[model samples]
Target: MTQQTLQRPSGWIERSRPAVQWTALIGLSLGFGAVLFWLGVPAAMLIGPLLAGIVISGNGGKLRLSRHAFVPVQGIIGCMIARMLPSSTGGELGIHWPVFAAGVLSVIVASGILGWVLVRMRVLPGTTALWGVSPGAATVMTLMAEAFGADAQLVAVMQYLRVLMVAAIASVLAKVVGANPHHAVAAVTWFPAIAWLPFAKTLALAVLGPLLGQRLRIPMGPMLVTLVAGVVLVHHGWLSIELPRWLPAIAYAFVGWRIGLRFTRPLLAHAARALPRIIACSLALIVVCGAIGAVLVAVAGVDPLTAYLATSPGGADSVAIIAASSNVDVRFVMAMQMARFLAVLAIGPATARFLARRATANANAAAAAAASSTDS
Candidate 1:
């Protein structure tokens, strides 16, 4: 037979590519998410997709969810937070400015202490330890760690581990404290009302939010942008809408997937070795935050559920999801999270650098002492 006649069809392979990718993405994310959701995992949509992303992407296949997809997802979440924040549905999240301020400061201080402890114990590199334990701004810390001489991958691993731990722990805690998120959404009948106009309006604003955020140089542009617009519109009484609950679930999944996809084989190995330390560090932060949360309970007059959600170490989107379902004050929780997030962004780098230097000096001194003893 002629060589050309015997050649396998490259066209078939090309045609199969997209189909294969879609099957993997849908099957893995949905399969995992559905099972976990049924099992009563908090933010199951996010967690399931996140875990699946790690498994699928980590293996050999690639899922083709576009980066641009995050914009609307974030926007949807933002609107939801704004819509539910001041609603009359949940418990009164007393806005105790003084206690809230104290809580924010406490979270930062506690995280810094843990970061130093990590450095001292050699749990992680200096910069990585510092930024990893910072209270908020995981994405920012991961992105900026390299500039401050931290291993970006290691920082990401640490940050994400804590995030995963916090989400898991906090979800359980929310239930124990009577902040049942499912019940929180039970009354919100605006969801599942899928229509074109409202969705389009939401999308337009969501799309515009990012464009404006890009122009304004806002960190975490899409979320903050749509978020600000939503809040502003709500107060002015110019905008009113509710998004399909499914969109936010997708957003959560995307967020988790984004973090999970970064876990490369070598990075996974490093993370595995450091898993115990990472878990310990994460638990330490939660303990400290929990203590501070107690103070918030007494001083703020806010329910335990709201206080805990506000002080939890995860990002705003995470807090909001739990808050929305648990009947915590979504607005108050967002405010606290955003404050901590911004605070970490501003001070985390400097603190990390200082701690990194201290770590190096300590290592050098220890090595010198060992050398002197050996020489003698």
Candidate 2:
């Protein structure tokens, strides 16, 4: 009958709201699955929830469009554009130091600038903005954000959304210019060899990445782990892994559903005040990065569009899809995409720590001033 006893039970009930959580989880899963089915695997590369997150997070408008609806439309447009890029181009654009340096520089500079703007505006916390604008894999950002105590979900969503938008726009432009986007040719089937080495390596890397992410406080643990492992496997010739036909679609759907779920009125209100700045900063970064990437492509004597897609801040899968469809070197595109992703993932936590430290120092200074005034 005591007041404390009554309050404790109510708090426990609220915490144990299994029904609501389950509903959200199941709804998200199904919604994501449906999006994959609707868009088809190849098209879904840009249709995922992460892509939706960008639009949702960057939405400055009053009207609320369901991410579910928007992602598919975007994907369709992206796919159409991807279908227009050349299926094969001359080999003049081989990877080299200058090209690599340009890509790296663009990503770093753009990501830093966008992160600084977002944090200064207070639309999002510094760490969250850094992770969100890191221009890496969505999963990497998420894991790093979690380790750094930023809102991982928000960062992941926003980063993915930007990827979708960029991919869609890029693809469309490529097609409009009369590029030849070709479908992937079916590979010769090899009998499944019972190779334990590849599977074991992949599993080990996956586990290790998360552990390192936890210890080092990296974001998007699973993604970082898988990407690193995948690269190692490919490099060692232990695995000739290609993304499954269904994966891009599935990834996009899950991303889209996750984004849609965050579309509540209250969150929208908060995003409104700072949405314009966030969008402007992100767009500026993209344009600058794209221009640098274009220069690198021209210097390397490679197709400009391929280089642009590779260095673009869009998701790796989407870029890969565009590369594959357009006859660009899939391996080269994936390699660069992975490199960019790793760069963003690795830097996110460090950037966050630095910003957080500065913020803490300022707060401490303010507190000291307040105490001195009180004494006076």
Candidate 3:
């Protein structure tokens, strides 16, 4: 009998140590922290990096301008809207079913239109474009789109880019309107060091949730899991973690930086050919959705502007932040936005794929007919 000996190769373990993984993590954390510090002194609400990293690496890019640019703008908008809402829930126009319905309808229409535009312009595959334009949870939309055969990477890029854009734009608008916004509530400073016990639990859930989601083949993976886990923890009172005051702003800045980096010459050249149609469709979608939202607001007897912002196909977090800052019924707007997002996350990709397939079939049929006629 002969015995065989197997020798391990050198540096095999080192080589397998997760390529370029730390780059995004370290960069996101440091960048977010720096932004937070610049916004204020020693604000511990620095979890922006965790969220931003999810957005950056999720798209296989370190950063992109489109995604990074929108976050702060959206945050400012969210803050302004939040201010508009009644400090106490016992106001004349309470959060009701009508408000919810209007918000949901607005998001659905806006997101659908945006998706269609992207598909027609070929900036992204139809399915991916649909999910990318959705104003709901980006991670959730990404996962669902993947299940429906959408391009996950493209969806991640689009969703994050929208967030960055919305955030940036909203912030500017808020500033213009003379709205004073609160920094993101720092997680560390809000309750004390021991407050993290609940956050740790929520984080554990976030980690486990993503793993489970991935095993289930969820699209946006960890990001969606973390969002859902955070919401649930908050709702359940098991975790009372507050975001740092500058967290949203800093997070958004990181998102903007990432998105801005995507503007390379080649990408821009491709966009140039397609940008007109894409912009047209996107604008059309926004108008239609905005109209719908305005009508709903009127019917619900709520402030039209808040409804408009909530229903806008921008981004949930951005809208949430706007609603928060502007006193615009943050819960209602955020809830509706989340709902619409869920709908898009669930159905947008399937709808886009269906449309794409139909277009392809029609083109093929037309080509076949032309050939037959020539032969005849």
Candidate 4:
């Protein structure tokens, strides 16, 4: 191949197409973030980009992101999780362990049963329902749902919808009671550092994690492997890594873009029909969790805010982000949220299997009934 043939000339408009799309994506994300922040919705970094991507997708623009594209993002999240711990379990949690543990378990069981019901009713596919209504563990659940024959785009929409709702509810409740609620996306305002060291470490880990996990046939391979490595390394003092503040937004933007790209008219219509019911059910779950929080407040002598944060159906990252600036007890909130996240992680596969079986049974029974009617 000659040099000229190999390096063909590019037109200005053609070259600008890629740049224009990316610029639009970035602009939309920032606008969404700013608006969500102004409106006091928590976790704007993730939610904003997600909604932006949906808008772009709805408008017929093509912006696709894959889980593999988000490997670095997941790695950053994993590292953040492992590194943000207070270096101790904190003795205060011991006082309310039983109550908090019960609260966490309640979220899992309640959401899982809801997932089961949704699946049996054919509201969502079995695997989609399993992870879509899950209370926490966003990265793991999304990956697992995709692995189990679910629609990743739908899972992202449903999952992030719930996350945003939970954040919205929390923000509303915070304002109702005269509390100064924290802005979870405030981390975005931090200046980006010369983060090459952390970036280098994260790059190596991100590259290695999926490869190893896939080799071992582990589920949600990249997230699980990277997260586990981060936890182990952080706890053992082998690696000290801190991601740049802006990186998380990029990660979320990519996932959102990819998800939005999948939104054709049919999917949007389905989502429009389904989202109200899903949002209503999610609010109900939050209410149930609030009752548990009330019980914790009464019995454990913790404040209502602390109890609420502990029992909130939101994921660890958002909860942690909000907890950072709130008057609530961070230790207790994290302890409870982490407990539920881990519990869901452990029990999710089993629940998914059960849902799949139930779905199969329902289909078989329906088919048999149809055959009998046909004979009649």
All predictions: root-mean-square deviation over Cα?
A: 5.9, 10.4, 10.4, 8.1
The lDDT per prediction is 0.71, 0.54, 0.52, 0.66
> Which residues of candidate 3, in runs, are more than 4 Å off?
1-95, 98-102, 109-165, 176-178, 181-249, 261-266, 373-376
Off by over 4 Å in 1: 1-21, 64-67, 87-95, 125-127, 147-150, 179-196
In terms of lDDT, the poorest run of 10 residues in model 2 is 81-90
Candidate 2 error regions (>4 Å): 1-98, 117-128, 137-157, 178-270, 359-376
Candidate 2 structure, TM-score to reference: 0.54
- Cα lDDT, model 2, residue 328: 56
Arranged by TM-score with the best first, the candidates are 1, 4, 3, 2
Top candidate, metric lDDT: 1
Q: After superposition, how far is residue 314 of candidate 4 from its true place, in Å?
A: 4.5
Q: Any residue pairs clashing in model 4, and if so which?
A: 65-258
**TM-score for predicted model 1 compared with the true structure:** 0.83
Assess every candidate by TM-score: 0.83, 0.54, 0.55, 0.65
lDDT of 1 by residue, 126-150 (tens): 5567777777777777877787677
| Residues forming the 10-long window of minimal summed lDDT in candidate 4 | 178-187
User: What does the lDDT come to for candidate 2?
Assistant: 0.54
lDDT by residue (tens digit), candidate 4, 238-325: 6666666666556555545544555554466667766776666667667877887888888878788778888888756556555543
Candidate 1 Cα RMSD (Å): 5.9
